[model samples]
Target chain A: MKYLKNAATLTFDPDRCTGCRRCVEVCPHCVFEMHDGKARITDKDRCMECGACALNCEFGAISVGSGVGCAAAIIRSMITGGEPTCDCGAASSGAKTTDCC
Target chain B: MINLSSVKKKEDCCCTPQKNKNFLARTPEITGQAVKSLSNITRERPEWVTGILNTRSGLVPIVTTEWTRTDRIGQIRSRLGGYRMNYSVRPGLYAVGAPDSSSDVFISANYKLSFDILRRALRGISGWILVLDTRGINVWCAAGKGTFGTDELARRILGVNLAGLVSHRRIIVPQLGAAGVRASVIKKQTGFHVHFGPVDAKDIQAYIRAGYHATPEMREIGFTILRRLVLVPIELNQALRKSAAAALVILIIFGLQPSGILFKSAWTGGRPFLLFCLISIITGAAITPILLPFIPVRSFALKGWLAGAAAMAPLVTLTPLGGTSALLDAAALIFFPLMSSYLALQFTGSTTFTTISGVKKELRIWLPVYIAGLAISIVIIILYKLQSWRII
Candidate 1:
């Protein structure tokens, strides 16, 4: 399902994108597209800011403030004081652990 | 020096190693004694490990594709949010089938289910499975958390001495893990090329058959009905647990008659309120997720609020409370929707497509509104109770 409009932190630069299409391959949301031998952000809103494309891109063409998008995690971090994480035990123990749904 | 040949000979005679047996006692020291020692301290070999594979670097534990009754039970338990945080496989190198030095290496999270699905997918294929320590989390969430990440990948690769065990310099990482693993960074650190495979482990066989090239479909994340449905049980369980406590407080509040706690009033007034609370929980936690795409609004909170309102409208108006108390009806209408909206907002974590920025924005706009609505509804209920007791 689509989230908020104009809420994604995803950004791309065509000059740095060598059209390697790594972003196209790595993005689960199909946010990137190849146009004129350069990578372009076709669906900016579809970006979940997972940082997959940016992490996989060797040319530094993509960037985003990627993280877990869960309200519970956000609230937990706010209360416990750390990066947002789902791992309940580790959140208080100062361990860099993250659990899943 | 340990007698590697003697260990190999003994392991070959048995189809399965006994539980708590020292699988590392006779193996070579180079095979990572740290993992073995940790396992030794635990005094148990993971039931998934059927035997050991004799390799050049060391002996690697071999896992089977078949699921035991416990694994199946664990899957169900995890789905229902039991033992979820502790369900994990040991983070190390493992063998599937009769893999050799020339076999391909596949990466996975330490989560038992993730490891199970990966091994099950490689039913006919022989490969080395390098599971990274993600603290029992699935790849997608761990990758987002930076546990299934670059530093961890590099460390695990080196820790396992993967170069000596595999002839190929390439490691196949799941596509979702690309969120944390940088192919270039991994290559630079370990001299191993990271080839992101398909998003789903089920597509691994096809991905390999296609020469490690994943079609767009394989890479795309699909939140189908089954996937969404699978996540609902945990949401339901969690919502119910929290609501149970809230329901108790509500009942106590309903029983407060200014003449102290009255059981009759609590049973009469609180029973209907409790039913509405359940309806809100189900709407927000179960219905909202299942009908997510079809819902009219992009905002999860709004969709949940709307759905909750729709579900409660008939109940509030048609129920006996409607004709008897207008204040109670108004309170029910307002409170239930807000409850649903708050629960629906929490479902954003279960969703695959939501972003941090989007959730933050949603919380910024909706949290205060939910608080205000809750306060107003509580005030209305108090007013109705005061009017009933003639205390005001």
Candidate 2:
């Protein structure tokens, strides 16, 4: 399913793309496509900004502000004051398991 | 004693002296029986661990592809939102079949479901499973949160002395984990080349058979009807919990007759309100997700609102509230749709495609509208109550 239009933070620089196709392979949303021996952003809005592309890119061709998109987590962070996380009580207790969404 | 010292010497060359000491300390009763020695040295194993395989690194726990009755029960419990976070396996190295040092190493998250699915997919395959500590989260969510990340992968690789356990330099990581793990950085840190496998564990065998090449379909994440249906139980559970408190508040508010509290008024006036709450819950948490693609709107909140409106329309016309007070009917229509909208918006967390930026934008615009609608509805309810009481 799609979400808000033009809201994704994903950006790509074709000049730095080595056309390794790693970004095209890793993106869960199929946001990247290869054309003329170079990777291109075919569906920028479809990007969830999970940073899979940027992390896998060896030539520094991609950038995005990646994070969890849960509103409950964001609301919790506003109250608890920290990075948005769904780890519930585990974050404070230094526990390995969490009872969260 | 001679063999112990020889093993120690080999370990010293591969890992730190402290780690070697810790390993020796954990295995105080190591004996001469090669097969039993490794298992005996390891501490108490979990129930799922059927046996131990003697490997170059040490004794690794062996797990079967078959699911135990307990495993199936736990899966159902977690799906129903019972002890979801607690359903996790201990993170470490495990063995499938009779894998030797030359076997391929597959990496996974410590979440029990994720680990189970992977092992199940490996049915007849013999391989080494390297599970990373992701605080009991699934691979995709853990990767997004950066727990199934580069540092952890590298650290786990060294901590287990993986190089000593495997002949090849290649380790197969789940493709979804690419969000947090940088293969290039992992190679530089651990000297093991990261080869991303298919997004789904079921495709792993096919991927290996195709010379480690994942077709485009295997790489793409699919939000099938089955997947969406499985998530509904948890969503419905959470929505019901919140709705309980809301129902109580509604009953109390309607029960207030300016004559302290009246059960008669609560039973009569609050019935419609309670029904509205139930309808909103189902619309937002259940129907919205199940019919996500078929829904006309792209924004989840709007879809929920529309669905809520459609469901409430029949109730509004059929119920006594329609004839008694126009104001109360208007309030019910406005407030319940907004409630459904808010609930639907929360589903962005469970979805695969929503982005942080997109959800933030949705909240910026829709949250204020929801708040405003709620305020207006409450005011209308108060006005209708006062009119009936003849106070205004």
Candidate 3:
């Protein structure tokens, strides 16, 4: 959190959460908890933004900006001017973007 | 029952083909059912995957102690072959030693390096190694990728018939893999207790001997000089691969400068830019990684720019051919720093420091500036090279 002084992008709503406990299961950081059958943000700062919980959440109840934190992915996104997942400048093959200029 | 077709076949392995000699050697204790179950799993096979052991609980895939030529080569390739190099073993419950139902079941990713380290550490110890399908990613990265998550772990346990094999209910997982795996959910759904071990595999033996309590040293992750240096090769290799074509193109373009596109002008004109590019690549990839912890900057890009500047200082000071063109000098000044910054930014994902949001935020703020700088320099250099514009 030294460099990332901003808040964790994770947001959870009890009403939206089905209490399936998927987020609690998928989150290695233990950032979320189960209380009264709803997922609760126990330690928001512990969240490393891996996006595992968000991807595994079936109910669309969980919302977190992708926490891939992949520097290559981020650099690729900037180079391509497209989704961060694309491999523009990345070593892998992906759709090359003309926006490198 | 899980659709395992998504897992790759042994023939599809990317490493050089070794006569299609795909086979798993089983110990005498291995049950026919266990052997069949293991052979059914067709993923990237590690050379250490021996066969099965008839443990008290059920069946566990046996990992060989004798490190083979494949492991030796795989280790070297993984070190120098960049982040994309994935030598994964099939995901299953593996036996590290003479394990039984009562032995500890440690879970890890399918990345062979991680698997090898775990098996190596538990040399004399008898235990179970439950490898999750992580698409050949390491434990930490796979956790981030969700391939080592609750679902996959649960699925693997069930798929391997782990309940029938082990008497213990607790599963020891890597601390770094906790991001993707939720202990509460596993306990709730699979009824298997999840226990996170120390962050490093080298400390696992000590951690286990100490009854699962981790020292602060075990818990801490350091960006040591040696660790930084090892990653340099892969980064350097990747940069060279991507830039070689560009280097050739630039050499030809610069050769186009003079009527003789021969060695005469090649040395005089084209070679200078190529040297600039190679220097940029080496400085960005090699020097930056080596000096990562020592670089006096908060941002990775800034650190890289500084490294490039440091590299360029000696080159500019030592060389005497500066009076020929102001454009090349200007290009070198701007381009090297830009390249270094871009390359250094790539390491953000791999480093222990820096957060995802932090990188994203940095990209939002600084990327435009770097790209703009690169664009302007390239434009000016190209214009000068074409003789359309001169520095007034």
Candidate 4:
């Protein structure tokens, strides 16, 4: 969670959150805080941008581009133009990749 | 009675005690003049039905299915000159048509998924698919275990009279099955070629379109987000419902009880307990997965414990006025994290990042701590309850 604030990799659009709180719930670092019935990343610094929030959002509120903190997946995705699954933002063919990101 | 002796033993088979009790009982026997009770099963095979029938040496022993049965069993039997079909292959193959010089022959496991995927992929292609009996498992896993290996593939090809059925010498197989199957040995034994296709069903269309050439990307294995996410629904539904119901009961118990605790001002309602339980649930099921990777610790259990500890912050500030509250806090601090960690640990089955050794190591290192934490929490809870009795 401490790595997320400055990472700027993930951005939260409160309008789309729907108050699901999945981000708040899934964040390992307690990066997200719900206030006045909306989700906010209060501990932005702690966010590793794992994209667990984005993946489970069910809404497009959370976006983290190709950078979700895993370096290998990103590298592979760049090489293959595939969507990255693990932290290394490699391009994977589909939303599924062997990587944890 | 049909003489099964005409059916040659495909290869090495040991009639151990257990094998006799199982497979021996199923072999068609001629004891009395038992009527061939043709079940009035008048249902015509659906268009999707490629084939189906009972198999030998299996728990159910039925291999034929309407899904794969393109024609009737009698037609198949007569077409093969009335040669008795060996039921030993649980997932067997049927070479349906006469072969021309370029007729392509494909190979697949008997696993329903493998069969369906391959056949569905080959839809209009006028080729043959040779299915191997892999005991109701997929090609990748079965191949890994040697069920779809060279010996079985070669033997099945021969047993089904494949040599006569096809003019072409090649047998295309899914690339994933290569782990167990020895291509060189299969080629030597059957004199048929083995061409490995892409690792996924979706890529089969492209492979066939590309003249049976598998691009390197097509052959690669993918555990993409979609694939990983599909597994979450069942687990989430089960965990959420069970934990919610349990948490509600615990909250009610904390609010009520002691024959008259509700009447005292020192004790509030179940709000606090409910809040704590909610925190635990969110952390256990929803949060653990969301923050799986960056939870600080390498061990999943530890990651959960850390999340639990962070969640306990509010409870620390809302300390109960009574000494019992101290004990209750300690108990909660211990139990909630243990519960969260345990749930997170179960996610290993769905995650690809962890090795078996890593999981074992985590369990060995953390299980004792989890158990101890839970034990302490329960003891403290009981002690707190008893201490509150005096104040009441």
lDDT of 3 by residue, B47-82 (tens): 575654444333345677667787777788877664
Q: What order do you get sorting by lDDT, best first?
A: 1, 2, 3, 4
Candidate 1 per-residue C-alpha lDDT over B119-218 given as tens digits, one digit per residue, 9 for 90 to 100: 9999988899999988787898888878899999999998777887778899999999998898988999999999999999999999989999998899
lDDT of 2 by residue, A2-97 (tens): 677898998899999989989988988888888999999887778888899998899988999887788878777767887787763263266543
Q: Once superposed on the true structure, which residue ranges of model 1 sit more than 4 Å away at CA?
A: A76-83, A88-100, B1-43
Candidate 2, position B390, lDDT = 97
Residue B42 of model 4 has an lDDT of 11
Which 10-residue window in model 1 chain B sums to the lowest lDDT? B11-20
Model number with the top lDDT: 1
- What lDDT does the true structure give each of the candidates? 0.83, 0.82, 0.68, 0.54
Interface RMSD of each: 2.8, 2.5, 6.7, 17.6
Q: Each candidate: RMSD to true structure?
A: 4.9, 4.7, 9.0, 18.0
lDDT of 4 by residue, A1-101 (tens): 12212434568898887886545543434557789888887755444433445644667888753222233333455579875334211122223223221
What is the number of backbone collisions in each predicted candidate, taken in the order shown? 0, 0, 5, 56
User: On a 0 to 100 scale, what is the lDDT of residue B101 in model 3?
Assistant: 71
Give the chain B TM-score for each candidate. Answer: 0.90, 0.90, 0.83, 0.60
Model 3 residue B251 CA deviation (Å) reads 1.6
**Candidate 4 CAPRI level:** incorrect
Each prediction's DockQ?
0.60, 0.60, 0.20, 0.02
| lDDT tens digits by residue: candidate 2, B337-389 | 88888888888888888888887888888888998998999899899889889
Q: Is candidate 2 or candidate 3 better by TM-score?
A: 2
* lDDT-superior candidate, 2 or 4: 2
DockQ of candidate model 2: 0.60
